[model samples]
Target chain A: MAQNQSAPDATRRSERSRRAIYDAALALVAEVGYPKTTIEGIASRAGVGKQTIYRWWSSKADVLLEAFLDLSGQAAEAAAQDRPSADASPYGIPDTGDLAADLKHVLRATVDELRDPAFEAPSRALAAEGVVNEELGRRFVATLLEPQLQLYVDRLRSAQEAGDVRPDLDPRIALELFVSPLAQRWLQYTGPITYEYTDTLVDYALNGLAPR
Target chain B: MAQNQSAPDATRRSERSRRAIYDAALALVAEVGYPKTTIEGIASRAGVGKQTIYRWWSSKADVLLEAFLDLSGQAAEAAAQDRPSADASPYGIPDTGDLAADLKHVLRATVDELRDPAFEAPSRALAAEGVVNEELGRRFVATLLEPQLQLYVDRLRSAQEAGDVRPDLDPRIALELFVSPLAQRWLQYTGPITYEYTDTLVDYALNGLAPR
Candidate 1:
């Protein structure tokens, strides 16, 4: 009885420390940016020993990547709660037999997430660092961004199968027509991001600019 | 006679110094990145006094902006040499009667420019900094990027007039479907960039994904 009770207590303690570490990593990266954010700083902010963070993560980049993944998962969960019947898997884009509508739906949610203060600051910091740091930028793309893009690829492939998209077009490149424009606007502040804007992107992307 | 001779000589010397300063500024930013680059460093690398740089520009950002403009002009001139009859003005995309061919032509040139090592490093450094630095990022977009985008806007407007494009679609947003993808790929290292890739982007953008 004593051993079982201690095991539960130990697991709870580990969980709390893990959450604290993630919070600290996100907060520090947002405050000081990636270059200045250190493992020691994260540990200190979390009120945990350096060994605790080391035991879980190999580097600050590793910690930030995991923290961001956790944050994205939480955002997806919250978004799912808003529409209980919608697919909750963060790994896939929903396919309701309407490609344009589905893309606009997800992109609008992305606009909201990008606008959120909690997500924006840290994300900007990491994205900025990745721009100058080639290795980090590639890793960020490979680990975080590519996975999200692949969802679009899958959706586009389904559309192609349904004869909704052109059979000759590559899905990866086809998706960029709509997806990249929104990303560029958000990343560079080139234009205002709104539901109206994203919806327009979907429409333009589906139909050629030339008279059809 | 002496004064006239000296005047031209002085002008030549000033022009040489200006070019050298531009080179130094580009190299320093590319090497050490935006934050570490300073007026003193640029001057030192150019073998000029710091006062010289201060006299010509108000800040490092000012120097960089001008340097990039000069580099772009030089690139355009070089590209113009390749196609002697092509419009050399960097301010507008060529509107040869065939919209698809004209857009593809320009995007192919852009692919070459983006691949240039001399242009790539410094441009990437500045662009990366802009991602995280809100004020700088806005300035970079407003001054450097938006002007280039406006050229596409002009070409698209011409297309609309000729019935090549639908009258209802906003030219500004429509251009992003093609432009932003190339920009995102170059900036993020998300994928390979080639003339073939840009040509495909043009084809996809002009024709809607849905079958006619």
Candidate 2:
């Protein structure tokens, strides 16, 4: 009976240690960026042995990726909880019959996510590295960016089936009309991103650039 | 009369030195990246003293910026010559009265420019630095990116007057739907760029995402 009780305590302790490691990894990456982040640095900051980090993840990139994934999931969950009406899908965008409204809703949430302090620094570090590092750039986009973009593709497909979007339009390219503008504004500091900017993008994209 | 001939020779030598400095600055940035590039290194590569660089430009940033502008001007001139048509304007996009075709033509040129090996490496170095360096990023966007983007804005304004685009749309933001998509694809390695891809972006931006 005592061993059984001790097992649960040990599990709790392990979980706590894992969280601390993730937090350290994220903070280190943000503070010093990707190239400077090391396993020893994360281990020291987390107050765990270097062996402890290695036991869980193979490399600094792995730790950082998982930490970011966790951070994004938490932010999404928090946003979803704050607004009960929000379409909270872990795997995809909400398929509300109104495609424009659904897209705008998701993009607005994305604005919040971009503004979130927890997500900003680490993401910027990764993004900056990806700018010059071709291998990392491809992997990061494949694993992180493409998945999110695919959600838009799926949503557009649904829009096509519903007759809201033109069947002839390639959803991949069509999604960029609304998506890439906000992304460029955020990445390049080209302009301010607000609900107003995103909303305008939707309207312009839905209606067309030319006179209707 | 001898002194007058010497004056012409001196002017030609100065022009050669200036071109050599610009070439060195771009080549160093591409080789070592932005952070590692220094005025001293540029000077050494140019076969001039560091003081010579300081005499002409205040900082490495200034040198790199001017170098890039000169490079882009050469590329544009080359592209213009390659075309069988009349002279292309240095200041604005072609406004051939056919808005879609003109936009597609310009964007295709941009696709070629981005893909050019001579432009790619140095550009990536500066762009990577821009991701983390806000002041430099803003400066680059203002001087280099914004000015080029404005040419599109001018073209779109003309389109609006011609009833090709809706007057209600913000051309600045409307332009991004097509422009930013290409930029993002190049900067992030998110997708492949081709004449076909840019052509599709033009169509989507000109038309609505919804059924016409």
Model 2, chain B: what is the TM-score?
0.96
| lDDT digits (tens) for residues A81-173 of candidate 1 | 775476636456778888888899889888899999999999988888887788998998998888889988888888999999989989999
Which lDDT tens digits does candidate 2 get at residues B1-212? 99999999988987888899999999999998888899989999999888878888999999999999999889878877766565348545777788888899889999999999999999988987887788998888987899889888889998999999999888999999899999999989988999999999999889888998
Name every residue pair that clashes in candidate 2. A208-B207
Interface DockQ of each model? 0.84, 0.85
Backbone clash count for every predicted candidate, in the order shown: 3, 1
Off by over 4 Å in 1: A84-91, B86-91
The predictions' CA RMSDs to the true structure, in order, are 1.6, 1.8
Q: What is the DockQ (computed on Cα atoms) for candidate 2?
A: 0.85
TM-score for predicted model 1 compared with the true structure = 0.96
Residue A37 of model 1 has an lDDT of 97
